[model samples]
Target chain A: MSELWFYILAGMTVAAATGVVMLPNPVHSALSLVATLFLVAIHYASLDAHLVAALQIIVYAGAIMVLFLFVIMLLNLQTDPDESPMNATAAIAAGAALAIAAVLGRVFYAFGTSGAGAELPEGFGTTKALARVLFREHTVAFELTSLLLLVAVVGAVVLAQRDKHDARVEPVEPVEPVETEGQG
Target chain B: MMEPLATPAHYLVLSAIIFCIGALGMVVRRNLIVMFMSVELMLNAANLAFIALANRLGNMDGQTIVFFVMTVAAAEAAIGLAVILALFRNKPTVQADEIGLLKW
Candidate 1:
Protein backbone atom coordinates (compact mmCIF):
# COMPACT_ATOMS: atom_id res chain seq x y z
CA MET A 1 0.00 0.00 0.00
CA SER A 2 2.78 2.41 0.86
CA GLU A 3 4.63 1.58 -2.30
CA LEU A 4 1.45 2.15 -4.29
CA TRP A 5 1.09 5.56 -2.70
CA PHE A 6 4.69 6.33 -3.53
CA TYR A 7 4.17 5.60 -7.22
CA ILE A 8 0.98 7.62 -7.31
CA LEU A 9 2.63 10.64 -5.72
CA ALA A 10 5.64 10.27 -7.97
CA GLY A 11 3.45 10.32 -11.05
CA MET A 12 1.64 13.41 -9.85
CA THR A 13 4.91 15.15 -9.04
CA VAL A 14 6.40 14.42 -12.44
CA ALA A 15 3.29 15.56 -14.28
CA ALA A 16 3.06 18.81 -12.35
CA ALA A 17 6.76 19.48 -12.75
CA THR A 18 6.45 18.97 -16.51
CA GLY A 19 3.61 21.44 -16.60
CA VAL A 20 5.74 23.96 -14.70
CA VAL A 21 8.33 23.91 -17.48
CA MET A 22 6.04 23.46 -20.48
CA LEU A 23 3.36 26.04 -19.69
CA PRO A 24 3.97 29.28 -21.55
CA ASN A 25 2.14 31.42 -19.04
CA PRO A 26 4.13 32.20 -15.93
CA VAL A 27 1.01 32.16 -13.76
CA HIS A 28 0.16 28.68 -14.93
CA SER A 29 3.74 27.58 -14.35
CA ALA A 30 3.61 28.98 -10.83
CA LEU A 31 0.36 27.14 -10.16
CA SER A 32 1.79 23.92 -11.45
CA LEU A 33 4.83 24.41 -9.27
CA VAL A 34 2.51 24.60 -6.29
CA ALA A 35 0.97 21.32 -7.32
CA THR A 36 4.38 19.82 -7.69
CA LEU A 37 5.33 20.95 -4.22
CA PHE A 38 2.17 19.44 -2.84
CA LEU A 39 2.95 16.13 -4.42
CA VAL A 40 6.44 16.27 -2.99
CA ALA A 41 4.87 16.77 0.39
CA ILE A 42 2.85 13.64 -0.17
CA HIS A 43 6.01 11.80 -1.05
CA TYR A 44 7.59 12.94 2.19
CA ALA A 45 4.58 11.75 4.11
CA SER A 46 4.94 8.32 2.56
CA LEU A 47 8.50 8.32 3.81
CA ASP A 48 7.13 8.90 7.34
CA ALA A 49 8.71 12.34 7.64
CA HIS A 50 5.44 14.01 8.54
CA LEU A 51 7.04 17.20 9.81
CA VAL A 52 9.08 17.63 6.69
CA ALA A 53 6.01 17.00 4.58
CA ALA A 54 4.08 19.65 6.46
CA LEU A 55 6.93 22.09 6.13
CA GLN A 56 7.16 21.37 2.41
CA ILE A 57 3.54 22.27 1.92
CA ILE A 58 3.56 25.25 4.25
CA VAL A 59 6.83 26.83 3.14
CA TYR A 60 6.92 25.96 -0.52
CA ALA A 61 3.33 25.54 -1.67
CA GLY A 62 1.95 28.19 0.66
CA ALA A 63 4.40 31.00 1.26
CA ILE A 64 7.04 30.84 -1.46
CA MET A 65 4.68 30.26 -4.39
CA VAL A 66 2.45 33.05 -3.19
CA LEU A 67 5.49 35.30 -3.51
CA PHE A 68 6.02 34.01 -7.04
CA LEU A 69 2.44 34.88 -7.96
CA PHE A 70 2.82 38.32 -6.40
CA VAL A 71 5.90 39.00 -8.49
CA ILE A 72 4.17 37.78 -11.63
CA MET A 73 1.27 40.13 -11.04
CA LEU A 74 3.55 43.02 -10.06
CA LEU A 75 5.56 42.67 -13.23
CA ASN A 76 2.48 42.33 -15.48
CA LEU A 77 4.67 40.31 -17.78
CA GLN A 78 3.46 39.12 -21.14
CA THR A 79 4.08 35.67 -22.53
CA ASP A 80 7.32 35.56 -24.47
CA PRO A 81 7.08 35.02 -28.18
CA ASP A 82 8.62 31.83 -29.53
CA GLU A 83 11.30 33.76 -31.36
CA SER A 84 14.50 31.90 -30.53
CA PRO A 85 15.37 28.88 -32.59
CA MET A 86 16.76 25.91 -30.75
CA ASN A 87 20.50 25.67 -30.71
CA ALA A 88 21.28 22.26 -32.17
CA THR A 89 24.91 22.24 -31.00
CA ALA A 90 24.06 23.07 -27.41
CA ALA A 91 21.27 20.54 -27.43
CA ILE A 92 23.59 17.83 -28.63
CA ALA A 93 26.21 18.75 -26.08
CA ALA A 94 23.70 18.72 -23.26
CA GLY A 95 22.36 15.36 -24.35
CA ALA A 96 25.82 13.87 -24.40
CA ALA A 97 26.55 15.23 -20.96
CA LEU A 98 23.33 13.83 -19.53
CA ALA A 99 24.04 10.43 -20.94
CA ILE A 100 27.54 10.48 -19.51
CA ALA A 101 26.28 11.57 -16.14
CA ALA A 102 23.60 8.90 -16.08
CA VAL A 103 26.12 6.20 -16.87
CA LEU A 104 28.51 7.49 -14.24
CA GLY A 105 25.77 7.68 -11.66
CA ARG A 106 24.79 4.08 -12.29
CA VAL A 107 28.38 2.93 -12.03
CA PHE A 108 28.96 4.89 -8.84
CA TYR A 109 25.80 3.55 -7.22
CA ALA A 110 26.70 0.00 -8.13
CA PHE A 111 30.21 0.18 -6.75
CA GLY A 112 29.59 2.15 -3.59
CA THR A 113 27.54 -0.50 -1.86
CA SER A 114 28.96 0.51 1.49
CA GLY A 115 25.73 1.50 3.23
CA ALA A 116 23.83 -1.73 2.59
CA GLY A 117 24.46 -3.00 6.08
CA ALA A 118 23.55 0.24 7.82
CA GLU A 119 20.42 0.41 9.95
CA LEU A 120 18.14 3.34 10.64
CA PRO A 121 18.40 4.61 14.19
CA GLU A 122 15.46 4.22 16.53
CA GLY A 123 12.82 6.97 16.52
CA PHE A 124 14.17 8.02 13.15
CA GLY A 125 10.96 9.64 12.02
CA THR A 126 10.14 11.34 15.28
CA THR A 127 10.33 15.13 15.63
CA LYS A 128 12.32 14.68 18.79
CA ALA A 129 14.99 12.75 16.94
CA LEU A 130 15.18 15.34 14.19
CA ALA A 131 15.34 18.25 16.63
CA ARG A 132 18.01 16.58 18.71
CA VAL A 133 20.39 16.25 15.81
CA LEU A 134 19.41 19.60 14.33
CA PHE A 135 20.01 21.49 17.54
CA ARG A 136 23.00 19.55 18.72
CA GLU A 137 25.08 18.41 15.77
CA HIS A 138 23.90 20.59 12.91
CA THR A 139 22.99 23.71 14.87
CA VAL A 140 25.49 26.01 13.20
CA ALA A 141 24.46 24.98 9.70
CA PHE A 142 20.82 25.29 10.66
CA GLU A 143 21.36 28.83 11.97
CA LEU A 144 23.29 29.72 8.84
CA THR A 145 20.34 28.62 6.68
CA SER A 146 18.07 31.01 8.58
CA LEU A 147 20.57 33.79 7.96
CA LEU A 148 20.60 32.94 4.28
CA LEU A 149 16.83 33.20 4.15
CA LEU A 150 16.99 36.58 5.84
CA VAL A 151 19.42 37.82 3.22
CA ALA A 152 17.23 36.52 0.42
CA VAL A 153 14.20 38.34 1.79
CA VAL A 154 16.13 41.60 2.10
CA GLY A 155 17.59 41.22 -1.38
CA ALA A 156 14.19 40.58 -2.95
CA VAL A 157 12.66 43.62 -1.29
CA VAL A 158 15.52 45.84 -2.40
CA LEU A 159 15.38 44.61 -5.97
CA ALA A 160 11.62 45.05 -6.20
CA GLN A 161 11.79 48.59 -4.74
CA ARG A 162 14.52 49.65 -7.15
CA ASP A 163 12.14 49.21 -10.07
CA LYS A 164 9.50 51.33 -8.35
CA HIS A 165 12.01 54.15 -8.12
CA ASP A 166 12.73 53.81 -11.85
CA ALA A 167 9.00 53.94 -12.64
CA ARG A 168 8.56 57.07 -10.53
CA VAL A 169 11.57 58.84 -12.05
CA GLU A 170 11.11 58.02 -15.74
CA PRO A 171 7.66 59.63 -16.20
CA VAL A 172 8.53 62.80 -14.29
CA GLU A 173 11.12 63.99 -16.89
CA PRO A 174 8.66 63.69 -19.81
CA VAL A 175 5.96 65.50 -17.82
CA GLU A 176 8.36 68.35 -16.94
CA PRO A 177 9.24 68.96 -20.63
CA VAL A 178 5.50 69.17 -21.57
CA GLU A 179 4.82 71.63 -18.74
CA THR A 180 7.75 73.89 -19.84
CA GLU A 181 6.47 73.88 -23.47
CA GLY A 182 2.96 74.80 -22.37
CA GLN A 183 4.29 77.71 -20.23
CA GLY A 184 6.38 79.06 -23.19
CA MET B 1 -0.22 -9.12 -3.03
CA MET B 2 0.15 -7.29 -6.34
CA GLU B 3 3.88 -7.91 -6.03
CA PRO B 4 4.19 -5.25 -3.33
CA LEU B 5 3.11 -2.67 -5.93
CA ALA B 6 6.65 -1.89 -7.05
CA THR B 7 10.23 -1.90 -5.85
CA PRO B 8 12.84 0.74 -5.12
CA ALA B 9 14.38 0.07 -8.53
CA HIS B 10 11.12 1.18 -10.09
CA TYR B 11 11.21 4.45 -8.17
CA LEU B 12 14.85 4.96 -9.08
CA VAL B 13 14.13 4.44 -12.77
CA LEU B 14 11.17 6.80 -12.66
CA SER B 15 13.31 9.41 -10.94
CA ALA B 16 15.90 9.04 -13.67
CA ILE B 17 13.31 9.53 -16.38
CA ILE B 18 11.93 12.57 -14.61
CA PHE B 19 15.42 13.98 -14.25
CA CYS B 20 16.05 13.42 -17.94
CA ILE B 21 12.85 15.21 -18.86
CA GLY B 22 13.91 18.14 -16.67
CA ALA B 23 17.28 18.22 -18.43
CA LEU B 24 15.53 18.25 -21.78
CA GLY B 25 13.22 21.03 -20.67
CA MET B 26 16.15 23.10 -19.44
CA VAL B 27 17.92 22.65 -22.76
CA VAL B 28 14.91 23.30 -24.98
CA ARG B 29 13.08 26.10 -23.21
CA ARG B 30 13.99 29.64 -24.21
CA ASN B 31 12.07 31.41 -21.47
CA LEU B 32 14.00 32.23 -18.32
CA ILE B 33 11.06 31.44 -16.04
CA VAL B 34 10.55 28.10 -17.76
CA MET B 35 14.23 27.37 -17.39
CA PHE B 36 13.99 28.13 -13.70
CA MET B 37 11.04 25.73 -13.42
CA SER B 38 13.02 23.08 -15.21
CA VAL B 39 15.85 23.48 -12.75
CA GLU B 40 13.36 23.01 -9.93
CA LEU B 41 12.10 19.88 -11.61
CA MET B 42 15.64 18.57 -11.71
CA LEU B 43 16.05 19.31 -8.03
CA ASN B 44 12.81 17.49 -7.25
CA ALA B 45 13.99 14.54 -9.25
CA ALA B 46 17.13 14.43 -7.15
CA ASN B 47 14.99 14.65 -4.06
CA LEU B 48 12.97 11.66 -5.20
CA ALA B 49 16.10 9.63 -5.69
CA PHE B 50 17.30 10.64 -2.27
CA ILE B 51 14.07 9.58 -0.66
CA ALA B 52 14.09 6.20 -2.34
CA LEU B 53 17.67 5.60 -1.31
CA ALA B 54 16.86 6.72 2.17
CA ASN B 55 14.00 4.28 2.33
CA ARG B 56 16.17 1.45 1.14
CA LEU B 57 18.82 2.31 3.71
CA GLY B 58 16.24 2.77 6.46
CA ASN B 59 17.62 6.14 7.53
CA MET B 60 16.29 9.63 8.31
CA ASP B 61 19.33 11.61 7.22
CA GLY B 62 17.97 11.75 3.68
CA GLN B 63 14.80 13.26 5.03
CA THR B 64 16.81 15.86 6.88
CA ILE B 65 18.68 16.69 3.72
CA VAL B 66 15.40 17.03 1.88
CA PHE B 67 14.26 19.50 4.51
CA PHE B 68 17.41 21.52 3.99
CA VAL B 69 16.97 21.32 0.23
CA MET B 70 13.43 22.65 0.46
CA THR B 71 14.68 25.67 2.40
CA VAL B 72 17.39 26.36 -0.13
CA ALA B 73 14.98 25.94 -3.02
CA ALA B 74 12.64 28.51 -1.51
CA ALA B 75 15.51 30.93 -1.12
CA GLU B 76 16.59 30.21 -4.67
CA ALA B 77 13.14 30.97 -6.00
CA ALA B 78 13.08 34.30 -4.20
CA ILE B 79 16.50 35.36 -5.44
CA GLY B 80 15.93 34.00 -8.94
CA LEU B 81 12.63 35.81 -9.38
CA ALA B 82 14.25 39.04 -8.21
CA VAL B 83 16.99 38.61 -10.76
CA ILE B 84 14.40 37.86 -13.40
CA LEU B 85 12.47 40.98 -12.52
CA ALA B 86 15.64 43.04 -12.69
CA LEU B 87 16.50 41.52 -16.06
CA PHE B 88 13.02 42.15 -17.44
CA ARG B 89 13.20 45.74 -16.28
CA ASN B 90 16.36 46.23 -18.30
CA LYS B 91 15.55 44.04 -21.33
CA PRO B 92 11.72 44.12 -21.30
CA THR B 93 11.66 40.48 -22.29
CA VAL B 94 12.41 37.09 -20.66
CA GLN B 95 13.37 35.19 -23.76
CA ALA B 96 16.85 33.70 -23.41
CA ASP B 97 18.12 34.76 -26.79
CA GLU B 98 16.88 38.33 -26.38
CA ILE B 99 19.19 38.61 -23.38
CA GLY B 100 22.46 39.28 -25.22
CA LEU B 101 23.61 42.56 -23.74
CA LEU B 102 26.46 40.89 -21.91
CA LYS B 103 27.39 38.72 -24.87
CA TRP B 104 30.61 39.64 -26.63
Candidate 2:
Protein backbone atom coordinates (compact mmCIF):
# COMPACT_ATOMS: atom_id res chain seq x y z
CA MET A 1 0.00 0.00 0.00
CA SER A 2 2.70 2.47 1.01
CA GLU A 3 5.09 1.42 -1.74
CA LEU A 4 2.65 2.44 -4.46
CA TRP A 5 2.04 5.73 -2.72
CA PHE A 6 5.78 6.27 -2.54
CA TYR A 7 5.99 6.15 -6.31
CA ILE A 8 3.10 8.54 -6.67
CA LEU A 9 4.49 11.01 -4.16
CA ALA A 10 8.02 10.70 -5.46
CA GLY A 11 6.77 11.35 -8.97
CA MET A 12 5.05 14.53 -7.83
CA THR A 13 8.15 15.60 -5.95
CA VAL A 14 10.47 15.08 -8.90
CA ALA A 15 8.18 16.79 -11.35
CA ALA A 16 7.77 19.79 -9.08
CA ALA A 17 11.44 19.90 -8.24
CA THR A 18 12.16 20.11 -11.94
CA GLY A 19 9.56 22.81 -12.30
CA VAL A 20 11.29 24.80 -9.58
CA VAL A 21 14.36 24.85 -11.79
CA MET A 22 12.75 25.26 -15.19
CA LEU A 23 10.04 27.83 -14.57
CA PRO A 24 10.92 31.30 -15.90
CA ASN A 25 9.08 33.22 -13.24
CA PRO A 26 10.63 32.98 -9.80
CA VAL A 27 7.23 33.09 -8.10
CA HIS A 28 6.05 30.08 -10.03
CA SER A 29 9.31 28.30 -9.25
CA ALA A 30 8.77 29.04 -5.57
CA LEU A 31 5.27 27.57 -5.67
CA SER A 32 6.60 24.46 -7.34
CA LEU A 33 9.35 24.21 -4.74
CA VAL A 34 6.80 24.32 -1.93
CA ALA A 35 4.97 21.40 -3.47
CA THR A 36 8.22 19.51 -3.78
CA LEU A 37 9.13 20.19 -0.17
CA PHE A 38 5.71 19.03 1.01
CA LEU A 39 6.09 15.80 -0.89
CA VAL A 40 9.56 15.36 0.58
CA ALA A 41 8.10 15.72 4.06
CA ILE A 42 5.66 12.97 3.23
CA HIS A 43 8.55 10.82 2.12
CA TYR A 44 10.25 11.40 5.46
CA ALA A 45 7.07 10.40 7.29
CA SER A 46 6.85 7.26 5.21
CA LEU A 47 10.33 6.34 6.41
CA ASP A 48 9.00 6.50 9.99
CA ALA A 49 10.91 9.69 10.68
CA HIS A 50 7.99 11.64 12.03
CA LEU A 51 10.10 14.19 13.89
CA VAL A 52 12.32 14.92 10.92
CA ALA A 53 9.27 14.98 8.73
CA ALA A 54 7.62 17.56 10.94
CA LEU A 55 10.74 19.65 10.96
CA GLN A 56 10.95 19.31 7.22
CA ILE A 57 7.51 20.81 6.88
CA ILE A 58 7.86 23.46 9.54
CA VAL A 59 11.32 24.67 8.68
CA TYR A 60 11.31 24.06 4.95
CA ALA A 61 7.75 24.29 3.70
CA GLY A 62 6.80 26.93 6.26
CA ALA A 63 9.60 29.15 7.53
CA ILE A 64 12.36 29.01 4.97
CA MET A 65 10.01 29.16 2.04
CA VAL A 66 8.28 32.19 3.50
CA LEU A 67 11.64 33.80 3.92
CA PHE A 68 12.40 33.08 0.29
CA LEU A 69 9.14 34.69 -0.78
CA PHE A 70 9.85 37.72 1.35
CA VAL A 71 13.25 38.15 -0.23
CA ILE A 72 11.75 37.79 -3.67
CA MET A 73 9.27 40.52 -2.82
CA LEU A 74 11.98 42.72 -1.46
CA LEU A 75 13.98 42.36 -4.65
CA ASN A 76 11.06 42.78 -7.05
CA LEU A 77 13.07 40.73 -9.47
CA GLN A 78 12.47 40.67 -13.19
CA THR A 79 12.44 37.65 -15.46
CA ASP A 80 15.89 36.46 -16.47
CA PRO A 81 16.66 36.44 -20.15
CA ASP A 82 19.38 33.85 -19.62
CA GLU A 83 16.82 31.15 -18.88
CA SER A 84 16.45 30.20 -22.53
CA PRO A 85 16.38 26.42 -22.90
CA MET A 86 17.94 26.38 -26.36
CA ASN A 87 21.09 28.23 -25.43
CA ALA A 88 24.47 26.66 -25.98
CA THR A 89 25.38 26.94 -22.33
CA ALA A 90 22.18 25.21 -21.27
CA ALA A 91 22.79 22.43 -23.75
CA ILE A 92 26.32 21.97 -22.52
CA ALA A 93 25.17 22.00 -18.93
CA ALA A 94 22.51 19.44 -19.67
CA GLY A 95 25.02 17.13 -21.30
CA ALA A 96 27.36 17.49 -18.35
CA ALA A 97 24.56 16.88 -15.87
CA LEU A 98 23.52 13.76 -17.77
CA ALA A 99 27.04 12.42 -17.62
CA ILE A 100 27.17 13.03 -13.90
CA ALA A 101 23.85 11.26 -13.41
CA ALA A 102 25.00 8.28 -15.41
CA VAL A 103 28.11 7.92 -13.29
CA LEU A 104 26.05 8.12 -10.10
CA GLY A 105 23.62 5.54 -11.45
CA ARG A 106 26.45 3.17 -12.27
CA VAL A 107 27.78 3.54 -8.75
CA PHE A 108 24.37 2.91 -7.22
CA TYR A 109 23.87 -0.13 -9.44
CA ALA A 110 27.20 -1.49 -8.25
CA PHE A 111 25.87 -1.39 -4.71
CA GLY A 112 22.78 -3.35 -5.82
CA THR A 113 19.31 -1.87 -5.32
CA SER A 114 17.72 -5.00 -3.88
CA GLY A 115 16.51 -5.75 -0.36
CA ALA A 116 19.52 -4.81 1.75
CA GLY A 117 17.88 -2.23 4.05
CA ALA A 118 17.66 -3.26 7.69
CA GLU A 119 14.55 -3.16 9.82
CA LEU A 120 13.83 -0.14 12.01
CA PRO A 121 14.76 -0.57 15.65
CA GLU A 122 12.21 0.01 18.40
CA GLY A 123 11.15 3.64 18.89
CA PHE A 124 13.61 4.87 16.27
CA GLY A 125 12.96 8.31 14.76
CA THR A 126 10.86 9.29 17.75
CA THR A 127 11.41 12.69 19.37
CA LYS A 128 12.46 11.24 22.68
CA ALA A 129 14.89 8.87 21.01
CA LEU A 130 16.31 11.55 18.77
CA ALA A 131 16.63 14.00 21.67
CA ARG A 132 18.51 11.49 23.74
CA VAL A 133 21.14 11.14 21.06
CA LEU A 134 21.22 14.83 20.18
CA PHE A 135 21.58 16.14 23.73
CA ARG A 136 23.80 13.39 24.98
CA GLU A 137 26.18 12.73 22.11
CA HIS A 138 25.99 15.75 19.81
CA THR A 139 25.38 18.53 22.31
CA VAL A 140 28.46 20.51 21.39
CA ALA A 141 27.65 20.56 17.72
CA PHE A 142 24.10 21.56 18.45
CA GLU A 143 25.21 24.53 20.50
CA LEU A 144 27.57 25.51 17.73
CA THR A 145 24.75 25.46 15.26
CA SER A 146 22.91 27.98 17.41
CA LEU A 147 25.95 30.20 17.41
CA LEU A 148 26.19 29.92 13.67
CA LEU A 149 22.55 30.95 13.33
CA LEU A 150 23.20 34.01 15.48
CA VAL A 151 26.14 34.94 13.32
CA ALA A 152 24.04 34.49 10.23
CA VAL A 153 21.32 36.79 11.56
CA VAL A 154 23.76 39.49 12.48
CA GLY A 155 25.58 39.12 9.20
CA ALA A 156 22.38 39.40 7.24
CA VAL A 157 21.40 42.60 9.04
CA VAL A 158 24.81 44.14 8.59
CA LEU A 159 25.02 43.24 4.93
CA ALA A 160 21.54 44.48 4.12
CA GLN A 161 21.97 47.86 5.76
CA ARG A 162 22.50 50.71 3.32
CA ASP A 163 23.91 54.05 4.38
CA LYS A 164 21.40 56.93 4.36
CA HIS A 165 23.50 58.79 1.82
CA ASP A 166 23.71 55.80 -0.50
CA ALA A 167 20.75 55.52 -2.82
CA ARG A 168 20.02 53.50 -5.93
CA VAL A 169 19.18 56.84 -7.49
CA GLU A 170 20.29 60.35 -6.57
CA PRO A 171 19.04 61.29 -3.12
CA VAL A 172 16.55 64.14 -3.20
CA GLU A 173 17.50 66.97 -0.87
CA PRO A 174 15.46 67.40 2.32
CA VAL A 175 12.94 70.25 1.97
CA GLU A 176 12.25 72.82 4.72
CA PRO A 177 8.52 72.66 5.30
CA VAL A 178 6.21 75.49 6.41
CA GLU A 179 4.89 74.76 9.88
CA THR A 180 1.31 73.52 9.99
CA GLU A 181 -1.03 75.69 12.07
CA GLY A 182 -1.67 72.97 14.67
CA GLN A 183 2.05 72.19 15.05
CA GLY A 184 3.04 75.88 15.12
CA MET B 1 -1.10 -3.22 -1.74
CA MET B 2 1.08 -6.25 -1.35
CA GLU B 3 3.90 -6.08 -3.79
CA PRO B 4 7.53 -6.63 -2.77
CA LEU B 5 8.19 -4.31 0.13
CA ALA B 6 9.96 -1.08 -0.76
CA THR B 7 13.64 -1.16 0.11
CA PRO B 8 16.21 1.50 0.88
CA ALA B 9 17.23 1.42 -2.75
CA HIS B 10 13.87 2.79 -3.77
CA TYR B 11 14.39 5.78 -1.50
CA LEU B 12 17.96 6.16 -2.63
CA VAL B 13 16.92 6.27 -6.25
CA LEU B 14 14.32 8.91 -5.53
CA SER B 15 16.89 10.99 -3.69
CA ALA B 16 19.17 10.67 -6.67
CA ILE B 17 16.45 11.89 -8.94
CA ILE B 18 15.97 14.98 -6.84
CA PHE B 19 19.67 15.52 -6.62
CA CYS B 20 19.92 15.34 -10.40
CA ILE B 21 17.24 17.97 -10.77
CA GLY B 22 19.09 20.19 -8.34
CA ALA B 23 22.34 19.72 -10.17
CA LEU B 24 20.70 20.60 -13.43
CA GLY B 25 19.25 23.77 -11.92
CA MET B 26 22.54 24.83 -10.46
CA VAL B 27 24.31 24.15 -13.68
CA VAL B 28 22.03 26.00 -16.06
CA ARG B 29 20.16 28.65 -14.12
CA ARG B 30 21.35 32.27 -14.19
CA ASN B 31 19.37 33.84 -11.38
CA LEU B 32 21.18 33.75 -8.06
CA ILE B 33 18.01 33.10 -6.06
CA VAL B 34 17.08 30.19 -8.27
CA MET B 35 20.56 28.84 -7.91
CA PHE B 36 20.18 28.98 -4.16
CA MET B 37 16.89 27.16 -4.50
CA SER B 38 18.76 24.48 -6.35
CA VAL B 39 21.14 24.26 -3.45
CA GLU B 40 18.17 23.67 -1.15
CA LEU B 41 16.98 20.88 -3.38
CA MET B 42 20.36 19.24 -3.18
CA LEU B 43 20.36 19.54 0.60
CA ASN B 44 16.98 17.83 0.85
CA ALA B 45 18.23 15.10 -1.41
CA ALA B 46 21.11 14.59 0.98
CA ASN B 47 18.70 14.41 3.89
CA LEU B 48 16.61 11.80 2.12
CA ALA B 49 19.67 9.68 1.48
CA PHE B 50 20.67 10.05 5.11
CA ILE B 51 17.28 8.87 6.31
CA ALA B 52 17.31 5.89 3.97
CA LEU B 53 20.82 4.92 4.91
CA ALA B 54 20.10 5.34 8.61
CA ASN B 55 17.11 3.06 8.23
CA ARG B 56 19.32 0.59 6.44
CA LEU B 57 21.89 0.55 9.25
CA GLY B 58 19.42 0.87 12.12
CA ASN B 59 21.44 3.81 13.42
CA MET B 60 20.43 7.06 15.09
CA ASP B 61 23.58 8.93 14.10
CA GLY B 62 22.42 9.63 10.57
CA GLN B 63 19.11 11.07 11.75
CA THR B 64 20.91 13.22 14.29
CA ILE B 65 23.09 14.61 11.54
CA VAL B 66 20.01 15.53 9.57
CA PHE B 67 19.00 17.91 12.34
CA PHE B 68 22.36 19.56 12.03
CA VAL B 69 21.97 19.76 8.25
CA MET B 70 18.64 21.55 8.63
CA THR B 71 20.12 24.08 11.01
CA VAL B 72 23.01 24.77 8.70
CA ALA B 73 20.65 25.08 5.78
CA ALA B 74 18.61 27.69 7.61
CA ALA B 75 21.67 29.68 8.43
CA GLU B 76 22.99 29.35 4.91
CA ALA B 77 19.73 30.52 3.45
CA ALA B 78 19.67 33.61 5.61
CA ILE B 79 23.23 34.59 4.88
CA GLY B 80 22.95 33.71 1.21
CA LEU B 81 19.90 35.90 0.69
CA ALA B 82 21.59 38.75 2.45
CA VAL B 83 24.60 38.45 0.22
CA ILE B 84 22.40 38.30 -2.81
CA LEU B 85 20.57 41.39 -1.65
CA ALA B 86 23.84 43.25 -1.22
CA LEU B 87 24.97 42.18 -4.64
CA PHE B 88 21.73 43.30 -6.21
CA ARG B 89 21.99 46.70 -4.57
CA ASN B 90 25.48 47.09 -5.94
CA LYS B 91 24.86 45.92 -9.51
CA PRO B 92 21.08 45.65 -9.97
CA THR B 93 21.51 42.13 -11.33
CA VAL B 94 21.32 38.62 -9.89
CA GLN B 95 22.60 36.63 -12.81
CA ALA B 96 25.33 34.29 -11.61
CA ASP B 97 27.19 34.54 -14.89
CA GLU B 98 27.14 38.31 -14.79
CA ILE B 99 28.84 38.55 -11.42
CA GLY B 100 32.29 37.51 -12.47
CA LEU B 101 34.51 40.12 -10.85
CA LEU B 102 35.39 37.62 -8.11
CA LYS B 103 36.20 34.97 -10.68
CA TRP B 104 39.71 34.38 -11.95
Best by TM-score: 2
Candidate 1 scores an iRMS of 4.3
In candidate 2, which residue ranges exceed 4 Å CA deviation?
A109-116, A164-184, B1-5, B102-104
For model 2, the docking class works out as medium
Worst 10 residues of 1 chain A by lDDT: A111-120
Tens digits of lDDT, candidate 2, B48-67: 88887777777888889999
How much of the true contact map at the interface does candidate 2 reproduce, as a fraction? 0.56
RMSD of each: 6.2, 5.6
Tens-digit lDDT string for candidate 2 (A1-184): 7678777887899899989988998888888999999988877777777799999999999989998999898889877665775678888887887777677756654553555656667898899889999999999998998899999999889888885466533535332233354476
lDDT of each: 0.72, 0.83
What docking tier does model 1 reach? acceptable
Using Cα atoms with residue i matched to residue i, what is each candidate's TM-score against the true structure? Answer: 0.77, 0.87
Which candidate number has the best DockQ? Answer: 2
Best by lDDT: 2
